[model samples]
Target: MKTKYQITTFLIALTLLFNSLQLKATNTIIEPDSDKDKLIIYILRNILTRSHYVVKDINDDFSEYVYNEFINGLDPNKRYFTQDDLKEFSKYKYKIDDQLLNEDISFYNLVYSRFQSKIKNAKSYYGGLLAQSFNFRKNENIDVDYEKMPFAKNENELIDYWRKQLKLSTLARIQSKTEKQNAALEKDPKTKVKSFKELEKESRLEVLKSMDELYYRIEELENDDWFSTFLNSVVGAFDPHSTYMPANIKERFDQDMSGKLEGIGARLVQKGVFTHVYELVSGGPAWKQGELEPEDIILEVAQGNEEPLDIVGMRLDDAIKFIKGKKGTEVRLTVKKKLDGSTKVISIIRDVVELEETFVKSSIVEKDGKKFGVIDLPKFYISFDDENYRDSAKDMEQEIERLKGEGVTGLIIDLRNNGGGSLKTAIEISGLFIDKGPIVQVKYRDQDPIIKEDVDPKVQWDGSVVLLVNEFSASASEIFAAAMQDYGRAVVMGGNQTYGKGTVQSVLPINQFTKFDEDLGAIKMTIQKFYRINGGTTQIEGVYSDIAMPNKYSYMKFGERDLEGALPWDKVKRANYNQTNSYQNFADVISNSKKRIAENKKFNLINEYAKWLKENQDDTVFSLNYKSFAEEKSNQEKEVEKFDTVFDYTSNLTFTSPTYELPSLKEDPVLADKRVAWHKSLSQDIYISEALNVLSELKMNNTYNAIVKH
Candidate 1:
């Protein structure tokens, strides 16, 4: 995706630096030398085979393709091509192969001669379609009839007739073209009236229509699975990374790369063709309006409140089509909520769940009316677009600067759900909080390690720092979190550990590619491993939080370490950094923070919810009764809804007749067996609460004491 960085600098050097290898050959692929020639020819022929797309030509230009592609080029607006080493690749730009053994070359030439006959046959196909428009019986070899066959006994039986016809058509086209090409090439120049160049170009053009027909027919056939696998095999010869991700694989790819889409923001899955909601993102639209819960089965969808279309057996993508609409325009989801572990319908309106909804929030925790800065650094995000701006990094920089301006003596940088982004931004942001030093070290393939450093030595708001992380903070987030912990810039706190993702990736966009049918998307392959400045590796084994807290997200089978092909962790020499003076004995300060939470009824509520989650992780079954089920589901929703509600810990707000306050959270949240999870995050959340406490402490430590000041 980044055009500035090019792969194969070797190719670039060859054109300018290497002066001896350049040589030309008569008719086949030539190269600077023999070994490279073999590799080049093998690569070129196959690349052209895959990239040559066919649509009815707009101009019927009759231009030479090799020139059009390599010299003359495809349309200039189609910027699929990057500047290649023209001098280095000049010898290899050719269409025909002449270096094969006499027998193979002769056969190849013969097959090319009859390729035109197939093209002529293709013209008849268009004529057939046009003739049908005028009600003419054109090609009477087979009568085209449309009567549904008797219901087949099975799936295999239904495909039998269609499969045989496709097979016949495929074989006839390939055979005819092969016979003609080989036949034409065998004749002497005297026998062939056209010059060698003209004859060769004509030969290639002749095969174009046939190649187009064969490729299309194979793709359009009934046996998509078999044909797709075959196409993969053909493409596989190029490289391991070249792949065709089918629809199913593409779905997972989209989810992994970008979890947000223009939808209800509820996680769902298809269970026996019925789409069911598994979880609702906290603060999302469905969670905003009360009554939606886990185990809600979607029965229908209405686009902008249109007719509620039943999606009982629709595929996941099809269901998404019915759910997603233009932002701000509403979509009505008729959900079958599980009541008492049984299903019932509940409707909800969909709207965009802005990142602003998930951003670090603040509240003035008044114990004797003292205020402290609570800054949640969800993730170190980079602006995704080079055009428009404002991402986590830029906005976070402004937030920290604002807190500094706000006279907050201490800050909390929360790093939960922050999967990381722009590596460049991470280092720049890390530089903001600390003096200049190495933020992260990267080791590339066969290259020495590169230390990405922050040059700015001036610190911003250096009163006291506390960073918050959970099992989900990863990748670039780990880099900043680990460095801050190692440098003692912040007292890092979280559950047992952060998510381990110590690998660095560089995305490679392929050469000689086009934005045609089935785009060859960029591949983000792992090219390096990352190491922290204090001789630690954050792969699989993530950086541990200095102050541990209780976590509800069970780490048993999740995170980057659990994934296949994850790179192993390793360490490098430590980078020099100046540790800051202790603003306070934060260990005792954190103890007091935990004490405040444990004593508060709110923290205790979190613990109750954790135990509930543990007991019911595999609790995924529900029933279909209407009345009793609905009531049962409502009660369970109350429990889940109370899992993190701050009001659950206190009798601060009594239940009003209308069920007052934010619908997303209720006061005096469920007091039963599910209220202990308040401490779920707070118990292990030493860095977060400590941040609150330390900010108050730092205000006292600074000359600007008695009030919040950095």
Candidate 2:
């Protein structure tokens, strides 16, 4: 549920540079030598330079940043482009800024052309390397710290690099296969096992197949895709959140923002040569059909009564084209079931799939004989096209109403891993917690900061409130959490700090800048920086938690602070807002939580585990020898066993849906299953358990009680 980027669209009028209104409307067909790329670059440079939140000079430093970003993006693993190739590229290292100023793509052209040849050469290297059996008995190591490792010096060294990489991949597969065989033998001594040589041969063939699939997908990418990558590098130079989306990616972004898609409703991921069903969208056509399940590999796809087209080894995008069709259309899929390894042909109707998980959902939990409501907000989602479409704020309001009807005493708004969406929704949701106040301050380039306020004076939930956040809770999530924290209306809990992403982005249609009918895609540019009502910005220094909890990512470098080109933290004049007199002993509650966390053995072990994970992440070197690798893995497993009780520590809490949801659960079995699974997870979650404890301990002040009575 991690979102790599956060975006929010706002209305803006752009002055068009081009006036060719009579140009016939057509899809923009970008080619290797198309002038369209130049036009795009020119438009982007003009727009970003003028309207971006942080106006940066496109100087030598900017050029160097773009250079590194583009090169690393293309060959992050140092698998292609040797030191000599980089030396050749150094000529344009400081000239990219000049190239953009002149709308010259000489650097991009050279790199793209060289990269294509490198891909072709590397394909041959992998096939030949995988064809031969790897001698894992060799005492060697592969350093996976690619960022620190220098590129290969020559073609021979590059090929040797690929050989080592391929060997590592094959070794992993062989080891996994060997372990499985051993496990089977342990279960029933009659199980026949393959020899070491046989396993090695099988692993090599598997690696070869995967390599073929990788190259196939790479070859499927067009000149436009590579150009888009280069363009994104240029945009990313401005900030980490700002991006240049090609037409296809922009279309997908729209779908994700709307949280609706017309398809079979099963998310698919390409693994090797097969498309595996990642997850079935709840309440979707496929989920309703009940045959399609996660991990089921789709072998072939067919239109109604049409010949089945084998999608094996096909690019995921290409396969998706065949699987997705017009609404109400029939699509048949030949799938291999993961549960029993049985193959079956399942027919599904393509329809508008409203992703249920994207919306707000709540569960009632009983701890210490008190009922509390837990709301898991994935993001601050909203559909700009459909006004009536359910947004997070609207859904959240409804869910709160439902929970209140069920007489829940406390509320926990779980914003963990919520990477954020609509800014309007965040403010609206914040309004639900407080009567009315300034939610956040937005500062545009060379402009005075404008305070975005919640004018609504009606409070939805005045009881004890808790906000759960992590390093992944970012952007609009930060805005909402900051607002609540500033108002002293909720207890913020989770990681040390939330994901620091205070920048605001608006998706500007590139076609609007031109009268040309060809769709030129859109650029999601950082337009503004948001500040908390408390005068602090959530940019790099995200909202600090009231009660910092131990999590897997606590000790790791993550969130906006770790991202390259991230905006810096700042502060502004605090907004005129009143802190709520909701709780009697807020500081005492926080102190008690800290005391409990320190004394808890589970939390101590988790902290230890987090440290261990950080240590493991830092150590990227691995032994290539089979015996050494096996020994290392055994040692890791044994070390990991010391923290096995972390998962086993379950809270004795009961979670259930509201009474109104019970009938729907009975009607929709899939929904029931989802709720059951969610409830089970909540029951086992130590975070939620501690939150319940805090909620129970929180004493509502006389002001809150008087308001409730009134």
Candidate 3:
């Protein structure tokens, strides 16, 4: 007789044996062909079925998932598609799996065609609807719970739906204009206030212009773009993390992972018809030039001394094409400043802009005369193209050394909103805290779990540590936090739990698999699942906080468990590791923190605010009548005022950069301004204040008395 592990393995093998036979049958149904779309489907189907962590069979259930995902992707708000279109599209609801096997694109083609037609029809509907004045005085309400909303029955009903949406938009604008006019008149008795009729007409024109811009962007999408959307729908059925990326998207994804981009060093966002500068990268060329600022609208773009090309009403992507150029190239932008509504031409030399926010940043704070260090890691970033390039682990180690030089007693590693990056860096970072131990266990399909250990014996920071995390802390972040928590190395503090993403994905180039000349893009496929060293998987049940804190997302459904089709949480054999037993009074420290939080008025208010947010999120119906809408808006503002003190709360601690960074801050005023804003925000962060308190209470064991020895 076999042992339990062997028996379980044998059963899994037997199930896969049968599934392999079905896969073979499906493989015989279609051979790789010249058609790119069908070829992509073939490649994705094979890769997902064979290599994915969870083996989901291509059956009616999978087909239904793809169908719903595609339809929802096209018309999420149930705006464009009518019930008749859905009915026609539902014919292939259970046939998608068969179509995939047969290398057929009939369903996708049909849906895409119908969606295009609906978009065209919607343009006319919005234009006609916004041209006429909306009778906001009519007593009516609109339910915005679009997920459960039924599609319109006919063309007339569809037009009526558009009318309601446009009416809601126009009503909001009218209300805002009326309030501003009233305030102007109140401020100055001689102020010329526009009449209700004039404001209403102005609001309609604004709404109409917004709709036109939206339709123009929609019309700019090529057939390949829509096809990519359909392909993503198919791959997404396997898991939420698995996705298909076209060539352009893959390029941007690479840039994001590398935390570098070649441009004017300003982030842009399209509003109405113009692209506005959202932010300037600190220390970048634009920031150095000191001409471009956030909220400045780029009206036109010119290369060097060439004639300016008007970019107003241009597609944001098209505008970016003109704005971004090779390094050392000059690009002049005609800008409308947000400060004084003044038009000015600013020229700047483009260069490689490093996104400073993507890396590790540390601040020193003094609490009761004991200096504590806070490291805010946005992501576990790494440059995959070059091994010698900067990574989070190296930066973290250097920052720890600097803080140690500063004689800081305790350290807080903030991983809040850090959707994790490199797994290598996470393991390396974990090693900085512990001498040597297993960090995480990776398990792929049909293979024994492999334990990834930190073989390094040197501990970087042998002191009291506090790890801060929120619901957005995921993947590599969760792994590092879990390792520290398991080893009793740090006090994990944050929301109830983390983002609960335990799976690993590898981006594979589609062109590599085939002899194709064109760039076929890539696929990010989930290949493995990670488990904590203690044998518990951080799949659905993320690493729970040792000391839970109240946050705005506290009562929200934001973790992986809240998502559909997430992998089930399971365990494997525990990896061999030793607990550091570093904290002497860990239990007492947690108890004291809990007691203080229980009586804290601000925390209680935050909890109440979280509940109120949940209530508002659940309420989707709104009155469309002008009088009721205004009253509801007034009531909301009044109610929101009760929570206004949340922003006013500040800690007594003072945060500053390390001595090494002071020289750079003095050189770059933009960088100095950014640090000032960050320090200000940290001073107002109640969570960090609590973390510092916990850090103060923690007492290290004599066995690990490195910090005390220093």
Clashes of each: 41, 0, 0
- Residue-wise C-alpha lDDT for candidate 1, range 1-710, written one tens digit per residue: 11122234523322331122222221243332434223323332333232211111212121122223222111121111213323323343332223321112222222223222323443444333222111111211211111122322332432333332222233223333444555776774344344433433343343343334433532332322322232232232222223333345344444522264435666675543357764455446665565665556786666664545666545566677777765566777666544322233345566665555444433223323443455555445444446356655566666666655555556666676566666777787788776578888876545566788988766665567777787767788888888887766677777668888776543333222221233333332344567888767787888787766555554234465665334556677776665544444656666666677567554456556656665554354322222333344456668777675632323221111111212424543432112133223333343344455554554223422222222
RMSD of 2: 6.8
Alpha carbon deviation, residue 73, candidate 1 (Å): 40
Worst lDDT run of 10 residues, candidate 1, spans 652-661
User: Which pairs, if any, clash in model 2?
Assistant: none
Q: Let me know the TM-score candidate 2 reaches against the reference structure.
A: 0.84
Q: How far does residue 5 in candidate 3 sit from its true spot (Å)?
A: 34
**Superposed Cα deviation of residue 532, candidate 3 (Å):** 0.6
What TM-score, to 2 decimals, does candidate 1 have?
0.52
Model 2: ten consecutive residues of lowest lDDT: 17-26
In model 3, which regions exceed 4 Å deviation?
Answer: 1-33, 256-357, 663-673, 706-710
lDDT of 2 by residue, 1-710 (tens): 12223232332323322222112112242333457888788778877887788879999999999899888778877788999999999999999999988889999999989999998988789988887788888999998778888899998998888988888878877887898899999999999989999999998887787677667777887887778778889999999878888776566666663233339777676543468885566556786687886668897787997856767656667888899988899999988765434357899999877667567889998777788999988778777669999888999999999999999999999998677778889999999987777999988787777999999878888899999998878889999999999988999999999989888777777877655556888888887888999899999999999999998778887778888789898898999988888899999999999999999989998999988878877777889999999998899889989988865667767898889889999999978987887898888889998988899999889887576446
Which segments of candidate 1 are over 4 A away from where they belong? 1-260, 265-319, 326-348, 353-371, 384-388, 391-394, 510-518, 554-556, 594-605, 618-691, 698-710
